[model samples]
Target: MTTVDPTYAACPVPLPESERVLLGHGAGGQLSADLVTGLLLPALGSAAPAGPLEDAAVVPVGGVDVVISTDAYVVSPLFFPGGDIGCLAVHGTVNDLAMRAATPVALALAYVVEEGFPLADLRRVAASAGRAAAAAGVAVVCGDTKVVGRGAADGLYVVSTGIGHRPPGAAPSAGAVVSGDVVLLSGPIGSHGTAILSVREGLGFDADIASDTRPLHRLVAAMTAAGGTGVHALRDPTRGGLASALNEIAAASGVPVEIDEAALPVPPAVAAACEILGLDPAHVANEGCLVAFVAPERADEVLTAMRGLPEGGGAVRIGTVADHGEPGRVTVRTAVGSRRVLDMLVGEQLPRIC
Candidate 1:
């Protein structure tokens, strides 16, 4: 007879039936949400976070709120059109903190190297990371390195941990979004994911496509400075792209979100590429842009502030949080004046994409 663990047997909610982890679990979509709510949270028991998840955690330390975020980079083909794994690691962590309206203070980096990895390549990556950190106005204060046997690890992997200071009035969160809030996109979408996919598959197009992988802390600073308490939430559409980000915000805030399809800023190259690949631009990832939920009264000033910065020069109003609808619902008003429900990406569209 086989023995069953009491913890697994006694839980009121059933876990996923699948015995093995799937790639979709890391895709930051529906499967990922299920994994967290069903498996991870239950397993963690009292140790799990108490509220809705955010990109970074704001903890009060010594009477001051400190924001901390950690991310691991496993993007394949280390080098891409506009960035490499190292700089990406830095930017990613910084952006996570930025999403919470925090000012980044310092970073800690960790590296895992395969046994046969090249020293010159490692140095190149390190130099890139240093430059990125400098550009973001943050320092890598500490780090650790580990080596594993060949094939045990990829060529290299980087993990970045960011520490930031949250201002007294700065408390942007997904759950803070409210009905009648305006949705703003910092810039165009699909460029980053398209760039990575183009490089990975050797796709060619008329225009040059580059990954929009850059830091957005300064952009956030500007928005918060101008909008003040009106800025309710911020999110970087990365893994599951804009669709996933909006769905998350809606679910957390228990509000319906509606966007106009005609207003989405899809670059020509990205639009063409997505059409060819049969992928929705809304589901494509981005690195250098953010989604903002701001009160209508302050939306104009916030838009002006964002446009004043190069990073947010192309900012545009895309949609609004509805006053009434099914909670956690999202809909897109199509170009033909038809409305369709928009759900989060079901599975991985582009794997190892930042």
Candidate 2:
């Protein structure tokens, strides 16, 4: 088991004091946590999830543990570099199931389009969603469409629900993370967030940055095949990026997570963009990557397995779970060797960036 280094300190970021929902609440950070734990869960009462919230819920259905996930895509512009709202809907829901080590079986879509929205665009989105679902080896079995008055719907909105089957005895969850588990990142971070920002704001750069929107179930399957139960926890850092994802895992597992800042694989373009915008790469979003907690002994094997897949070609070991320190603590060992608390994203950096 790893021991906490003395260099780390308490988180310097203050807890949000707002009484009402803010845009940051949708950014998937500390504010989001407050919204869920404060309002949503209390309102849900007995219907709330018993443990830490996860990307998908595992329910016993007819003697089978079925994984179900649902997500809504309201990405601005409908289309962004490397992906569009349509395929994004499919990939997002599928990735959630994949985070639980589930094999995607079927998807359902619901579209809300404004009356004035172009029919051509709607057809384009449908075709794109079809292609994405087919490539992921899943089918869209059902759907609904609603057309609203102009400005009622923001061009278009897609809601996707995914059904998946978890392999028997394979349970990957945030709460399953433990001391000595090695933290591995599937690939680089911040690409999707930066790509969306660039296009939405019309900020052109010397090199093009594209959203990493793709299905990761196959990549996850490869990992489970190699690591089995040794892959303790899995999460796709989407909205609040790696920082929020890691913080949630640390809080759920009640362990200290420490990562080397220099070890994180951030693309140069993403890095430059974050630097330009005064955003932290750790707090930026990624559409098509995952963060994993693996048994320390099986880390190399799992990393190798991940690297073999095109989706995980840049996989790397970033950190470890510490046996000592405050529960739910996350620290970053900076380049100069000083350690500080790596808190969750405080507010909105890039809005409507899926």
Candidate 3:
């Protein structure tokens, strides 16, 4: 019997030339995308996953659809203006479940602490997380904590898992996203990334900007009630911003998406900061915004429902799923009347931006 290398035996496409993982690999950009499509999928032998991998994995047992999702938070400077890592972890998990139109019921939390970390800080983080979960009406049923060497871990990092029940008559999935569906965006973009950067860089813009970190489960319920099954897919533009989220949905749904630049709802502070820092607002990270793919007929209703919510006041219809099939691509129509391919960032523009 001969033993063969897994790369050569099972890989469908050639692996990347690089051997080491960089910060960009974790940026949720093109490199991250390649890692999934090129390496992980082949290694798992799950080229054909049950569905296009979205925010959460939906499992059906005993005729009940269960939504499960996990997320990790390592944003530098654990505390920011609008949120800290604690609230971020809870919000992230809750949003993931909500992406699939699921109602969050419970959460599990795990924390990694560096040596010499203050107990008071730990207590504060825990308290914040508890408050967030409580506000979302989700219980933190179980939790764990671990300590590592000073150099082994950052000050602190949080990992959270959420469980939710899929709503009846709601079948939201990336695969369900079809061409001609209206693309909607919830609130302004790039605030979270800009806020983090401003604090770290000592750059103060006119209006105080903060992370838009919050749970969207309630807003999701409003959409379901208004749009019913018209809501096709939902994506939280987190690590790689709105551009990456749209691209992911396009690739997963096997269709092209077109975005309108003039319609983007970028807050003034965020836009000015991005311009000064030479950052593309589209590629910046956002914690509390989401991209919605909805049927054209119900698009207005869903948009109205979102606008009525406090967390979704800035919701706007931004683009449309292209009718022509040019899958795995996104195009943006500029205010100047030109179109450009909205390619995923080859490397991270901002590392650990989430």
Candidate 4:
């Protein structure tokens, strides 16, 4: 007999219901989709008419393929050192579309304000969102506003939706990955996670630890320009970090992934924070970094292109995909020459990590 951990049962989001809001409803899975389709879409009038709403909605406009993705921001402690929730929301959605090799075009903003929330803070958050969008060269076209009862809502949450045009002949997906493909990391990992944890736990570090949240469409564009079709898959190791992202690609491509532990780039501050908190840096979150899988032949070219971009200055090849007899097996080569399996996060090691 097996016993389920009661702690896992205590989810952060509500469950799905006809009228009631549950934490599970925001899980980004089936229940979340149901909430959007069954309630929110109906009430707001279906802005997206297409049936299958994916990570991004693809639309054909004037012979160009446009991809759009939207996400909400409710991170506790509205402001952090490197970024605020508002800027994070913008980067999150824009990066999602960029992962598809799309050039970001426009953005839509939505605000849900709780009663008693300071007007000054709200204005600041909005300004941050606008500035982030502008910095990314994306426009804020439209939006909506809502107010909830004081006790029923958090201080302020911003939801941003972004649209971008996919470059011609660009194919981006885990399915595009093939054996012997090289895996690359844009920069050091675990910064965002450590920053959040530091603030939440009040862990004072010697250096300023801040969230590494920024838009990556420009970097993606540069890589695409260099390697084009040779770049197989691009993922922004956001929620589950590099380990989970690589595992996902391996599973989807039916390939084996091998990573070198010594090659992984982790900031010292981030490593220290992870050690103190008993967290694996590989499984920590990153907002500004990306993991790109490219053909081994073009890996160097891709690296050169990435290094030219401001966001990918520390880009390095960390691993490769190959046949390991069994499909979807991921192994990490330790510094001592030992190998270990890298498995999917069985359960939430850290919740609300994204």
Deviating ranges (above 4 Å) for candidate 1: 1-13, 205-207
Off by over 4 Å in 3: 1-18, 46-49
* Candidate 3 lDDT, 129-150, residue by residue in tens: 9999999999999999999999
Residue-level lDDT of model 2, residues 70-135, one tens digit each, is 888888878888989999999999999999999999999999999999999999999999999999
User: In candidate 1, what residue range of length 10 has the lowest lDDT sum?
Assistant: 1-10
Quote each prediction's TM-score.
Answer: 0.94, 0.93, 0.93, 0.84
Clashing pairs in 2: none
Output the better candidate (1/4) by lDDT. Answer: 1
Task: Rank candidates, lDDT, best first.
Answer: 1, 2, 3, 4
lDDT of 4 by residue, 129-246 (tens): 8899999998999999899999666787788888888867666776578888999999999998788878878898525688999999899988988888998988887765777677
User: For residues 63-126, could you state the per-residue lDDT of candidate 1 as single tens digits?
Assistant: 9989999888888878888888999999999999999999999999999999989999999999
| Candidates 1 and 4, the one with greater TM-score | 1
Model 1 vs. true fold: TM: 0.94
Cα deviation of 337, candidate 3, in Å:
0.9
lDDT of 1 at 237: 90
Highest TM-score scorer: 1
Model 3, C-alpha of 107: deviation from truth (Å) = 0.4
Candidate 1 collision pairs: none
